[model samples]
Target: MDQPRGVESAPVQQLLNLLVDRLDSAEQRGSAGVKSIALGERTWPALYMAHRESEKENLWEHIIELSCWGWLVVKPEVATRSRSGYADSPRVTVANILEVRKAVGRSTRIKSAVERWREAVREGLHGTDEVKAAVSEFCIDMPDRSMAEVVERLNVLPSLVGKELLLREVSSQLFWGMSKVLDKRQGLVAAVLGVDECPFPESPIQLQVFLPESGYHGVLFIENLMCFERAIRSKSSAFDGLALVYASGYKGGAQRLRTHDGCSLFYSTRGGFRQDLRASFEAWLFSKDVIPAFFWGDLDWSGMRILSVMRTTFLELAAWEPGYCQMLAALIGGNGHAPEAADKQGQKALDFSGCFYADTYLLPALHSYKKFVDQEQIRF
Candidate 1:
């Protein structure tokens, strides 16, 4: 909506901008010819959500003022009963979509960059999910970067620009945010560039060995460093004779262990870990007796997914019950944080972790409490 003289406030303007955008999108989808769009319709839930947010900011009255001034048409509030079936609540409906679109000066719908790119690469992009997502994001988000230019230079991906060129060229934000895209879908990049494999930069396998004098009995991968460090320092009998490896949040790339030189272990030579012990560690890691593999992380959805991901490689891998059980106890004891608080807002509530303890105990506890506990919270 136009900044009405002497009336436009920040919250009101933000609310109007959101409303106009929502209405404009509706118009783009054939709402231009239609007369009125209900604010409560399933298709327009965002409109209702925006209204509710404005209500919380005490900006709805200012919005009503704009409607009264003929800035936009908002149907008169209809009185409604609350969900409790007791209180009176009023529903604000948009009287017309065209009028709102006009207010924002959104004219004839034009194809977005993504749509144009999709049309151009019609059959070419059917290679892999990662390539498709990365290419679409490049076209839509990076207005200056040309996908055509990148495709033409795809042959020089690894040799000229280094292995991470495709990922680096696409978007730095996308690379780190969805780091496993290249790891999982490198085949598509290879196929496009006519190479056997995309030689992407790889991080050395990091491990914090805690093998006893008698030799390690099992391997445990800890997701977060805090918990990994805590587990080592705890001197708990439960972790005795277990080799602890800090997972470092590498999902699909963790499976690269089977590749030649993939198990190039990273260690601090200055510490107790001697340079000569590297070969023995690597050998034991690849040995058949590397059974009883366990993963321990936060009590969040992503943590469970990490366990599921590692399971693809370590088929025998299961959730580290002791660490997870402690987190579960803390969650049930009301000592956990909301998903938003931990920046885990995007983590989907996965029902299974391919491990009985996680699927039955951890997942249910997280779903029941709607909360997450960091593995570091449990010292023992």
Candidate 2:
């Protein structure tokens, strides 16, 4: 009798060849259905065992050994029977087997590709140290500064530097600068005669003044900053005739003046005069014979409204530039646009016979010219 072929040798060789062929074909097809069942769905045993005799060969053990050797292998399948008598069958189609094999190979390739990209990025970042340092510096938090100051400082930085990083680094400095600007403006009224630094009275209505002469007394009030600055600079010329007793600030510019030296500066917190101080200031003005006083502000609707408030306190108050006829003349001389119509409430107010010079001249001019002129515009 011919020597019987060994139980494992021939079949094992054939099986290995078959497995290699199947894996190659699966790679060519590039599908992962077999991997989904084997790895994801765990259907490996069903995929490997072709017939009952293959079970005795311990095919699963060999497959596991192949996996350790770097071959893409399927997981073992576990089955169960439900109360409904339906068997939990695992999918073991040849197509699924090939697909799983291909998927495993593709996954390995993708992981390797990603690692290469990450390494390249790491190397690139390392090469540019200056840029990295600048970025870190910019991201650091700083105190706030004003926009003007920030712009001024950033201009000094090298052009090669990133603007966004610079801005972030100096944001706080910019904000602080803005705050300082506002403080300077606020300190304007008090800075006159070095009075802002002086101590103020507890009551809001306290009146004080600093004059060259001891006996000088008068009621002095400013509506806005530019006009207030002009008045303070020309204090002697402006408040010459009056006793120079009481001084006050109002609106944007006026609220910032200081109350230093002997002069007490009263400013309105909101738009109109402070209620607690209003009557006191008016009484002081009347007592000091400060009637027919000069008033100056912008030549806009809002400016007129401010003048109207002053008029309620002092009937003799007269506007400096926002007079009705004066503004009308200015509007006519310039090639400017017309002003918009006042709303119903403003129209009724403007219709009053006692309306300011702006009401008579500027309002009508604005209606005709269809333009608005601010005080700053006239300064140039």
Choose the strongest candidate by TM-score.
1
What stretches of model 2 exceed 4 Å from their correct place? 1-221, 234-283, 286-290, 321-328, 335-349, 353-356, 378-380
- lDDT (0 to 1) per candidate: 0.59, 0.38
> On residues 18-43, what C-alpha lDDT tens digit does candidate 1 reach at each position?
66656656655656543333434343
The stretch of ten residues in a row with the least summed lDDT in candidate 2 is: 79-88
The number of the candidate with the highest lDDT is 1
Clashing residue pairs in candidate 1 (N, C-alpha, C atoms within 3 angstroms): none
Tell me the lDDT of candidate 2: 0.38
TM-score of each: 0.56, 0.29
* Every candidate's CA RMSD: 10.6, 23.1
Q: Residues 1-380, candidate 2, lDDT per residue (tens digit)?
A: 22112213444344433444554455556654433222111233342444554453354444343444444333233321222111233222233333333433432232232333333333432224443333222211224533233324333333323334322233224344332321222232122113443122212233433232322233444444554444334534544543222333333123222222212454433213444344444454435345445455545555556666656555565565433344455657783433443332242223331446656666666556555554433431
Question: What's each prediction's clash count?
Answer: 0, 48
